[model samples]
Structures are given as structure tokens and as C-alpha cells.
Target: MKKKSTNNKKTAICGVLIALAMILSYLESLIPISFAVPGIKLGLANLVTIVALKKLGVKAATIISTGRIVLSGILFSNISVIIYSLAGAAFSIIVMVVVDRMRVFSVTGVSICGAIAHNAGQLLVAAFMLENVNVLYYMSVLGIAGAISGAFIGILASIIIKNITFSI
Candidate 1:
């Protein structure tokens, strides 16, 4: 019975977090960063992924992350966006889980790693799709942007994780 209760709670939390992530995705789309770099954005939805990873563990976090990517892609963007997002998300979550398990870095460090990985993943996909290595030229610029955005999201995640009183 206790196990069942925990499962229910987990399900509920995943639902809410997925919804929140999708909403963030939409909200982020509304805001234009207008950087010189073509693919730069603050990655606002990543805040939820960081929080979910810390609070709910990798499996739950994975569910939430993929759920948000698929739902947001279908609703707000196109197939191309979905493919890029899935690639980036896959790389991001993998790096986050590894960094987090190492216990050497705080959430900020993990976020930085995840953000960089996400950018790399996207660039790799772009290169493959375009059949040109030039897409990777954006990595250095995107890496810097990733670190900045990751730090911002990480700080927010830390605050949210610290302040939340209830367990998911």
C-alpha cells in the first residue's frame, strides 16, 4: 500500500512537472533573445529538468524531460524542432546524470555540463542533417551561451530545490 501511494505521488509529480516544462517551453518561445548566434536561447525549460532530476531521480526526470520535449514539439513547433530537441535533451540528461552521480559538482556544475552537452548534441545533429562540418563551428559560441544560461537555470533550480517543503 505504501509503495502504491508512492507510485501515485510520483505520477502526480511527473504530470505537474511535465506540464510546467511545456509551459516554460511555450513561454520561452515567446521571448526573443536575439543573439548574433542563430540558435541561442536561455533554455528556460531546463530549469524544470534540473529540479526534477534533483528532486525525483533520473528515471522520473527522464520521463518528465522526454514528455515535455515531445508534447511541446507537437504543440508549439514542427518535426525538425522535435528531432533537434530530442537529440539535445538526450545529451543533456545523460551528462547531467553522470555529473550528478559523480558527486563532485553542485547543481550549477551539472547544469553547466548539461547545457554544453545539449548544444553539442544539437550541433552534431545539424551537421548530420546538413551534411557539412561547418555546423560545428558554432560550438564555441554556443558553449559559452550554454554555460551562461545553465548557470542561471541552475541557480533557480537550487532555490526551488532548497525551498520546496514537500516530497514528490
Candidate 2:
């Protein structure tokens, strides 16, 4: 049936996006760029996430993000990394979905908000794990980094979304 075929196509697309996310994550880890603050990176994998969201909807985006986190964690990092990644991705996606529904901002703005939320989520996890309020001090730095990285990813996603002709 057409419905089953559509589901199969979606599953395939989600798998590809998840693989792309993992590759980006791996490549990003290979680079030594540091912001002198913890938990600051390019967030390159977010491009795939945002693209998946725009193209495939929230369910697909959730699966891709979750798959990326778990696979990358198991392959390249540890349990702690998985926890932080999950928290950050969950917060980022939630904010993005809400902001996206409002239709008040461009993709770039939505991405900026998502990036900030991601940082906040990670900070929350860090604070909880470390049992100290000191982690909150990193917010300002992380916010700036998030804005920059988010804009970069957003621009990339926008371009990719425009050029790609696939539907899910």
C-alpha cells in the first residue's frame, strides 16, 4: 500500500539522516577547536537534525537525534556524554518545535533559540551531576557560542532544505 511505502521511505530517510549526524559528530570530534569553555563545539550534527525536522516532522527528527546521540555515545564516547547529549538534544528539539509552530521567526532565529536551549539543558545536567551552582556561570559564554554555531547550522540547513527535493 501507499501508506506502507511512505512509512518505509520515512524510515530510510531517518536512517540516512542519523548516519549523517553520526558522521558529522565523528568529524567534529576529530577537530581540536576549543572555545576555552567546556561543552562548546560547532554542533555540526544539528544541521541534519534541523533538516530532518523541516522535512520529516517531529517524530522523524526525534528518532534521528536520539539515534545519533546513542550511536555516537557508544561508538565515540561514554555514558556521561550520552546523558549530556540527550539532555541538550531534547531541549533543543522541544524549543525548535514550539518556535517553529509559532511561525514568528526565520529558520535562523529558530536555530538560535534551539542552540541556546541546548546549552541550557547541558548546563542543567552538569549542575545536577556536579552538585554545584558554579556551572551556571558558564551560561554567558555558552550562549555566545550557541548563537554563533546555531546561526551557522541554520544557514546550512536553510540552504540544504531549499536545494533538496525529497518529501517524507
Candidate 3:
């Protein structure tokens, strides 16, 4: 049936997107783009996540994001990294979905919001784990970084979305 074929196609696309996200994660680790504040990077894997969210919907985006985090954690990082990533990804996806649904901003705006939320979530986890509220001080710095990086990812996502011809 056409429905079965469509589902198969969707599954295949999801798998490819997951792989792409993982590759981006690996590439990001190689970039050496660190900061004095710690835990600051370009969030390159998020490009795939934003594109997936726009193209495949929330469930697919969430799955791709989770798949990238788990796979990258297993191969390149540790449990602590996984925890921080999950929290960030969860917050990022939720905010992006809400913002995107509002239709008030472009993909770039959604990404900016998502990036800020991601940083906040990670900082929350870090504060809890370290048992130091002082870590919250990092928000101002991280938020600015998020806005900048999110804007970059959002622009890339916008370009990719525009070029794609398929539907989910």
C-alpha cells in the first residue's frame, strides 16, 4: 500500500538524518572551538536537529536529536556528557516546537530561542550536579553564545529547508 511505502520512506529518511546528526557531532568535537566559560561550542549537530524539526516534525526531530546524543555519548563521551546533552536537547526541542508553532518568528528566531533554552537546561543540570548556585552566573555569557550559534544553525537550516523537495 501507499501508506506502507510512505512509512518505509520516512523510516529511511529518519535513519539518514540520525546518521547525519551523529557525523555533525563528531565533526563538532574535532573543531576545537572552546571558550573561557567552558561548555561553549558552535552546536553544529543542532543544524540537523533544526532541519529535521522543520522537515519531519517534532517526533522525528526529537528522535534524531536523542539518537545523536546517545550515539555520540557512547562513542566519544561519557555518562555525564549524556546527561547534560539530554537536558539541553530536551529544553531546546521543547522551546523550538513552541516557538515554531507560534509562527511569529523565522527559523532563525526559533533557533535562537532553542539555543538559549539548551544552555539554560545544561546550566541547570550543572548547577544541580555541582551543588553550586554560582554556576548560574554563566547564563549571561552562555546565552549570548547561544543566540549567536543558534542564529548560525538557523540560517543553515533555513537554507537546507528551502532546497529540500521532499515531504514527510
The TM-score between candidate 3 and the true structure equals 0.95
Residue 131 Cα positional deviation in candidate 1, in Å, after optimal superposition = 0.6
Q: What is the C-alpha lDDT of each candidate?
A: 0.90, 0.91, 0.90
Off by over 4 Å in 3: none
Cand. 1 TM to true fold? 0.96
Candidate 1 segments exceeding 4 Å error? none
Which scores higher on TM-score, 2 or 3? 2
- Segments of candidate 2 deviating more than 4 angstroms: none
Per lDDT, the best of the predicted structures is 2
lDDT of 3 by residue, 86-116 (tens): 9999999999999999999999999999999
Clashing pairs in 1: none
The sequence of per-residue lDDT tens digits that candidate 2 reaches over residues 62-143 is: 9999999999899878999999999999999999999999999888888999999999999999999999998799899999
Model 1: per-residue Cα lDDT over 1-168, one tens digit each: 999998999999899989998888788878888587765888988998998898888998899999998988888789999999999999999999999999999999999999999999999999999999977888989989999999999988898999985463
lDDT for 135 (candidate 1): 71
